[model samples]
Target: MPASLSKGGAARLALLLFLSLIVLVFAVASATAIGDYNIALTTVFLSVTNELGLTGADIPPIEQSVVWNLRLSRALIAALAGAGLALCGAILQALLRNALAEPFVLGVSAGASTGAVCVIVLGIGAGSLSLSLGAFAGAFAAFGLVALLSNGATSGPNHTILAGVAASQLFNALTSYIVTTSGNAQQARDVMFWLLGSFGGVRWPDFQLLLVVVLFALAVCILMARSLDAFTFGDEDAASLGVPVARIRLVLFAVTALLTATIVSMVGAIGFVGLVVPHAARYVVGPMHLRLLPASALTGAIFMVVADIVSRIIATQQTVPIGVVTALVGVPFFAIILYRARPQA
Candidate 1:
């Protein structure tokens, strides 16, 4: 690399870091001050402190349970889901040569949601492990359909998304038939909120598991940044340049499926993070995949955390669904981008 280009990269990185910090401070402050659904941000922070034995005053075990087991778990889970979605979307857009591509565009989320509903509505998950396994299977099925339809990597962008759409419609139809045919009022309620998505009812073990999964996904995204950058020049071009296109695509898809399934099983099908955050990050950092990947990951984590905070605070005594909050935030931004994007030459 030229000396000037190296210097330019450093300057841009510094600017990204400074901007990210400002966003983080605002997110922490907003999360700390806003109140409504149940507890204020200060209370949430103090509760965390109390759990860690860092608080000056002694609080009851119940208080610790409430903060650590429920709220904090939800916050972290939201962050994990967001980061995973955004990271995957960043990879997919480059790989597919499709600007409209997103992590869920291939119906992985729909398939996972279908599988989860089967468990929730059918009393299938005897344990948490079963739930995760089931969701992963469903996500894998969705991706499998895509791969097969594409004839093991010969398929184009539209063909893959089309395959995903067809599979999703089938899953949705099955899900609807199952729900309607079962005629179980109790199960219907579970399915409804699961689709709406919330961080409620989490435990300490689940929280730890979410943290580990997210860290692993983040690591993979960082390591694969070079491969993603290779994708910018188009697949054939990259291949001529000695990039192993098929191998990299397979690896990315598997990692994304794993990450997406892990989150779906835990947090349900929260929307917009994967679809919105990557684009926003690109707007911030331009189209350098190496930087874009990590930048998107951070942007997504913060985006969901803030959205979750707002969801908790928007209503008195009742929490809004985080999915709804995400859609509310993402839609307008998406529209603006669509309007502003230039025509491809």
Candidate 2:
């Protein structure tokens, strides 16, 4: 859908996407096969088929349980989370006209962290509230504050970014205060770990919820792809081209918020996937939103699934947080982006 892409370019793009999907499938299968117990790929396939009722190959109960109840769900969730975050990053970058824009830039992650800590440390909701729900509320609360500070979606990009910084600091401080003052040592430890991100506890339910959210968000973004392309030329240019800048900005921002909040609540604010994946995807797919969005999602999915696999085996008898793995990769890429984005001498 890129205006500049010719027939040859389209063929290349299609091939690239096809290959990416193949790699993603392989990465996911690898994830399901390479845990502590290390099931074979054949067993993994049969276990999956067995669960789908597509085949009735007899498998050991424990191995089947590990694949079905544990690794498969975690891998799928990682893929979805990656795809969702990358999509949000792409959306924010175009709307804000900033190459560095990412989901956490709006302070959503910080707010989710504060909300989660409140649930865990303060026993909020009198034992009725789930951590995910609390974090969701907190994330939206941060979005609300940023919206107010920046005078809603119509504010200049710089103003919105500044508001996001303020909101992040405020929520981060609140999280620290609650953890330090109210939570006991064990509670503090738990809260800290969750904030670093994990796929350890996710199951089919989390995957299902995220699949729906990510699919819906991707569909919405694809529908608005042309408007997003218009926005890259600045709001006035978009308006001149008959794009409804204000309404589109509001809708896209809300969509990003929905995605960021949902993911943070589920996985504890994994970083750099959103920041790094979109840029890499743009390089491969060019700057068109139509191609860029799905490409970014696919790249993000592969990146995260691989990251999850790396996290599992990086240390002897220990699991690194998925966030930590992403940070390790993203920080160098972040510096490269910054260096390239520096003002020309």
Candidate 3:
């Protein structure tokens, strides 16, 4: 697809984005309402509106508290995490020209988990380094390792995927070793649950932080959308077309690291939003980054909020790890991609 959209295409994209926004709002509300203690959908709306000072509707204090204090934050964070991951996946797919490129597949999420464990268990930097910062460093480290193993960005998709698998195993094992050797039983339990992914510990502060990171990253990516479109062809083609290939790649890699690290720090290492959402978005919006980035963000937000809801209800009185829910959906999608990409007989 061309970087620029035709007039009719642009109008269709706008309509799609507008409709997706509405769906995202509904998805978030549904997520907020369908927890262990059910809150009515109307109550969910009034609770949110009341908090915003938009209405003075009478709502039960407990319902209000749950909606405003707990579920709302989690839903918002889930939305942001999904959007961020999807954006990372879209950007990476373009930069690498590989459909399977994403944070989870690239081992960025595992690397971030290892870094977070370093802070929580080993107390890396002795109380100076924040978990997000540590994860950012570790994410980049993993990226660097993959780059080395695959012989830089020019490596074939199979080689890159192999490098990512190696990185994931290495970081996951390191995380386990650190917890087992340094952490107590209680800490071990907490770390293990977190590594698998959870939204239970998040609050408004987390939502606020993630909101900023995701929105800022989206804006940056949007501005670079044309460059990303150029990248889909090849680095040589991109360079020939006046794109500064090296700088754009570095900046985008940094953005991806920042997003993956922040999300892993806050919500643990959730997977597959990055892998699955972008492809789905591209199906809807076509492959232009200008349209695809926002489409991915909206689609991702909806997908994750729905996943979070499933995690709550899938077990009797127990919340499955959000990662597990995503993996269930993602693993099938992953297999499909692999089969489709397989060489013809």
Candidate 4:
């Protein structure tokens, strides 16, 4: 309602959203059929149906475990994490008025890496809560430091970027130092793999936590869509439109940080979903946040599920890291965007 859309445009938007959702569902189902075991699509469908109590299809225990526990959980995490990251990226770009802003642009990922490194390498918290707690702490710490150094959310994007860069460098250095000096070879390998990201070890519990967080974040983002529209014009313009510029900025930042931290804790700093998916959605839907957010979430979920499938298939004996796959795909897209965004000579 904020932005006027012609009937044709609205219909097109609806079609796009519909198509994106279809793609997302297909991606999830297909991804579940991928991996080393290669479960049949029929089995995947039946197993899901049986679990939901729609029908009692007799399935082998091992296949049921693989489908329900391993593949489904991994697929769900990939979907939710992708959605959350993309949502955060869209929010950050709007909040900062910067095209390049993303979920990790503010050092939250680096901080998370540092925290996870501490737990894994130093044995700092050595229990169920160790990794997640450390990651949340470090993420919030980095965000707080960035806010302080940038003189809070009112300091503009440049200052915030600089502060984030500084914090990122510091946390990244700390992670590196810990890995190089204190960690054993196994710990080092684990840390490196985690930093690069993976979904190999995810299970129902992890998926459940991520599902809740991502859904809650999405709801909050959708509620704030109108305010995000006001923000696109600039701080003064938004304030004139009755938007509380600073307060909204703070809320957006906190939500993004919390979402980023949760995902990073679950699956170690997977990159570029936040960056690439939002830009892609914006291109399709224009600058309207209301349309862009859902489109971005769906696009991101599809992208991540596909990327996860690629990661599994890229190597027979060993899985490729999700971060590596994303980076390989995202870097070229980013370059193209930058090139196109540049002024014509």
Q: In TM-score terms, which candidate is top?
A: 2
Q: Mind giving the per-residue lDDT tens digits that candidate 2 earns over 1-345?
A: 556567887788789989999999999999999988899999999999999999999999999999999999999999999999999999999988999999999999999999999899998975688999999999999999999999997888788889999999999999999998999999987897888899998999999999999999999999999999999999899999999888898888889999999999998989999999999999978899888999999999999999999999999888998889999999999999999999999
The 10-residue segment of model 4 with minimum total lDDT is: 1-10
Residue 194, model 2, lDDT:
88
TM-score of 2: 0.97
> Which residue pairs overlap in candidate 4's backbone?
none
Candidate 3 C-alpha lDDT tens digits along 1-345: 443778889888889989999999999999999978998999999999999999999998999999999999999899998889899999989987889888766778888888888887888975789776777677778877877887765565567679889998999899889998899988787777788789888899888889999989999999899999999998788889999887787678778877887888788888888999999999877898999999999998899899999999999999999999999999999999999999998
lDDT-sorted candidate list, best first: 2, 4, 3, 1
Model 1 misplaced regions, further than 4 Å: 1-8, 11-15, 18-22, 25-47, 53-56, 60-62, 125-130, 341-345
Give the worst 10-residue stretch by lDDT in candidate 1.
Answer: 29-38
Off by over 4 Å in 2: 1-7
Q: Report the Cα lDDT for residue 169, model 2.
A: 99
Candidate 4 residue-wise lDDT at 284:
80
lDDT-better candidate, 2 vs 3: 2
lDDT score, candidate 1, position 9:
91
Clashing pairs in 2: none
Q: What is the C-alpha local distance difference test score of each model?
A: 0.74, 0.93, 0.87, 0.88
Q: Alpha-carbon error at 215 in model 4, in Å?
A: 1.7
Candidate 1 TM-score, C-alpha based: 0.87
